[model samples]
Target: MLIKYLGHAAFLIRNVEGIRIITDPYSPTQGIHYKPIDENADIVTVSHEHWDHNAVDLVGGNPVVIRKEGERSVRGITITGIPTFHDKEGGKERGENTVFVFDIDGLRLCHLGDLGHKLNKEQISLIGRVDICLIPVGGYFTIDVKEAKEVIESLNPKVVIPMHFKTSSLDFPIAGVEDFLKGTERVKRLGSSEYEIEKDKSPLEREVIVLKPAKSS
Candidate 1:
């Protein structure tokens, strides 16, 4: 499976069969200056109703959009939406968020969509085993660097991809990815936005992989 970062919290995940899935398609009008998401996908997952994360109309191809929490299969890909929050105060401050888990090409990929708080025992149990984790490390609106480290320890994914942080295009009051990578070991700066995961291959010793935004201005 191939995972391409489309800036912010959005990602385009494609399996070997060419089934494409997009997570948290952001809106350029919401002060996020990243290039518009004009790509096509078979499935689109919206984590919340926020303008920056739920611009379903921007995506082409008449894709099937998943917005709620549950288990479903589309085009032979199994996805489970685990209910979460956009704030630590149980959605009172911001709103509810859905963490989407995709089972594609014999790998379990988890996308934490604007996750706000640390994971409890039940949420971790529901998420099950994660191979690749797409997490948000920016502080103000989501979990900060400290909390992100704790969450990573909880999920224990083989590969960690940090997203939704400060970038040149984003104007949100969030910390840059550098804040999360400070003093971190086994960090691989790919310099590109795309990464391919082989099912039979062993996990990388370099756990944290940073990818440049694919849709920057």
Candidate 2:
């Protein structure tokens, strides 16, 4: 499978069969400047009804949308959405969030959408084992660096990809990715936004992988 970080929390994931699944497609008004997402997708997952993460209209093709918590299978891909919160206040402050777990090209992947709290035992159990974790490390609207590290410890995913942080294009009041990478060992910065992973080549230990934003358009 190929994972392409298209800035912010938006990502384009393609399976070996060329099926595309996009997560959290963002609108142009989300304080980030980039070429609009013009690619077509077979499936799209929206974590919440927020503007930044639920810009379904921006995506091409009539993709199947999955937003609620439950199990769903589309185009031979199985996905499970675990209930979570957008803020530590249990959704009272921000709202509910859905953490999507699925398999693509034999690799189990988890995408934590704008998560703002540490994972409780129940939440972790529901997520189960993950090969790659797409996490949000920015504070204010999501979990900060400290909380993110805690979650990573509990999940113990093989590869960790941090998202939702400040970038040159983002104006959100959150710290940059550097704040989360401090003192971290076994970190690999793939200068490009895209990374390809296979099940047989899964890392033996936890590693943080930083990806640059893919050129928009």
Candidate 3:
């Protein structure tokens, strides 16, 4: 399987069979209307209803979308939607968020889309073990660097990819990439949008892997 981080929370995962699954396809200036690129894929997994995370229609394909509050299987992926609040205490502000835990190729992956606050013990128990975590470190609407550190500790994922931050297009005044990389022992930039996360290997300690945005069409 190949994991490609497409800026923000967007991701493109391709299996050995050449089937592709896209997660949170968000592009500031290259969708069907806003962003011109076609996000068409075999399956599209959305973590929440946020504009940035639920732009599934922009992908331009009638892909099966998984959301709401249930466990649904799509294409060969076992998707479990764990209900979560968008904020610290029972979503007193921005509403609710859906955390997706997908099991594919014998690997379990979790994508915390626009997660606003730190999770508690109950929330942690729901997620279980995660092989990879696509996390947010943008702060204003999500977890910051410090909070992310705690999330990492609780989840203990084999691979962690930071997302939701300032880009050349995203106008929101969120923290930049440096804030996530600051003091991180190992932050390596993967040249392209794709990579492979293996569990047998050792993590770079407290390192974070920064992936470049996919080439806009």
Which number leads on lDDT? 1
**Model 2 ranges off by over 4 Å:** 215-217
> Whole-model Cα lDDT per candidate?
0.94, 0.91, 0.76
Model 2 poorest 10 in a row by lDDT:
28-37
Q: Write the per-residue lDDT of candidate 3 for residues 128-157, one digit (tens) a residue.
A: 888888898888878888998889889998
Candidate 2 vs candidate 3: the TM-score winner is 2
In model 2, pairs of residues that clash are none
lDDT (tens digit, per residue) of candidate 2 on 17-93: 99899999888685766567787999999999998889899999899999999998999999999999999899998
Report the lDDT of model 3 for residue 190: 79
Give one clash count per candidate, in the order shown: 0, 0, 5
**Against the correct fold, how does model 3 do in TM-score?**
0.88
lDDT score for candidate 1 against the true structure: 0.94
* lDDT of model 3, residue 153: 86
